[model samples]
Target: MKTLLSAIILLSSVSAFANCPEFKVPKKFMARESLFSSRATDMTFDAGGNRIAKIEERLLSATTTFDLYDNKRQKIATARQRMFSGGTEIEIKDCAGKIIGKIKERVFHNMFDIYSKYSILDATGKVIAESEKKEILAPSFSVTGTNGKQLMKMRLSTFSTRSLDEWVVEILNDTQADPRILLMIPAFKTSADNRETEK
Candidate 1:
């Protein structure tokens, strides 16, 4: 049943983005495990292996700051998370430094890190989408729209190795969601899980 559902999502994603050539529909993206050293995450194309977007973390800062860039290395969006906060809060902005969206972590079943929830908000602080971590052995997340409709499903690719990990972003619905938001889902999972271990 899971495999069938995944196949349906793949077909829907390809069909929905087929007409839109301008936006690149990302199949998978790599996020490095940056714990001690400062490293950046890059989302690349599978065909030519060209980088489509990059996420960089700031050095020696109290709060976590991330800069998102495009293929041309142009700044597209930025995410900032404050330190010493109970709940995780990340603010996303456009290249012009305008607020675009925010990701707020929500409380869920705290038993064995099996469940988690996050709310994605637009500039006006309206909930545009919501993400929930699936309770499975392999890492997976389900993104739903404001109307409680599933929009996308992100799964950590099985081809991931020790050096790098890839996340497959599959669009499930016809709704157009910002790719940057989709990219941030796995990143949040990594960071949030790390936080839980520290406690």
Candidate 2:
């Protein structure tokens, strides 16, 4: 009876430890002072060793990115991406893998450089169907207030659950168009007013 109890306790401890992130600070990355420059300091895994989430703090910019994965080793979701500097850009596609949505941010210069972050939402405001920048023009609507009127507007955001058991959060407008049409400027930039059929 004693041996059996000991074995059960040992197994429980192992299970608890496995769920925790195998956190490690790389020697080279740790030398940097920028919090934003730091990479994912923590990574949690499931019992099968599949990555669940990674937490990384940004130094250059005051933002954080959380990368999430599905059980099949597919990159299902990411909390942020624009500041990662040419990091892998993930797309939300349909069963046919059509480009339903995207998440990306870019730095541009007028006299000074403008950094913008945006995420595109679907009509239902559940899925982050696509992403774009303010300077870029999408296939949909044009931003033209009445000739003499400056029609400035903002939108409310909503979240959606994917078939893969992943979560997608988005912001949208009141109209029933693809919420991706709305451009959500990062807090750093001035707010700008704001897809898809599945296979």
Candidate 3:
């Protein structure tokens, strides 16, 4: 059943953004996992199916780490989710190891919102964005910037989300935010949920 669903997701994702030769997708693209993919790695591809980046997830020292790579296989960024201390934050760093952004869990903030709420922070550790999952009429996930603009939107191929390890991402065309940081949000959120489930 899982394999069948994975195949469906693959088909939906491919069919979603194909047949447009004039459409050039660089920033606006999808990051997806291989069919029958485990939770180990994911590949980012443009609409033409050209590889943009690759993210590898690993467990190290009680922390879940996701390393991003370019098509050339050069490391670009890293996201680390600290499992200890209730796994409050996931830190994103550039290849230089400098912190670029963070995904923070909000415990008190959840009281007001039916869905889980998260704060996105820049390198300075200042909260600069917000994310919420909406399942109203159209089930979608959106990350909003400080200016109250949607940074990116992630929606599943099917209405049901089979796994957090895989996704269909579409970064808004007009967003001025860094794409590197935005891409890390999904993995961090997945790690956050894993931490919660373990508890």
Which candidate has the top score in lDDT? 1
Tell me the tens digit of each residue's lDDT in model 2 across 1-199.
9999999999997676445232221111101111231232223222223333232222235454443333344433334334356332323332222333444444445654333434344423343422333433211212222232212232211221121111111222233222222221221121111001121
lDDT of 1 at 11: 93
Cα misplacement distance, residue 30 of candidate 2 (Å): 29
State the lDDT of candidate 3 residue by residue for 1-199, as single tens digits. 9999999998987675343222123645665654223334444544557777766778676667888777777677788876434326778877767777887765433434445466788888888888876535544578888888887788655523444435577767465345666777655555445545556
Candidate 3: Cα lDDT at 190? 53
lDDT at residue 137 of model 2 (Cα atoms): 26
For candidate 3, report its TM-score.
0.67
Whose TM-score is greatest here? 1
lDDT of 1: 0.65
Q: Report, for all candidates in order, the number of backbone clashes.
A: 0, 10, 0
Which residue runs of candidate 3 sit more than 4 Å off their true CA positions?
A: 1-27, 34-45, 83-87, 107-114, 135-139, 159-166, 173-176, 190-199
Assess the local accuracy of residue 95 in candidate 3 as a C-alpha lDDT between 0 and 100. 72
Q: Is candidate 1 or candidate 2 better by lDDT?
A: 1
The reply for model 2, stretches above 4 Å from the true place, is 1-37, 41-88, 93-100, 117-199
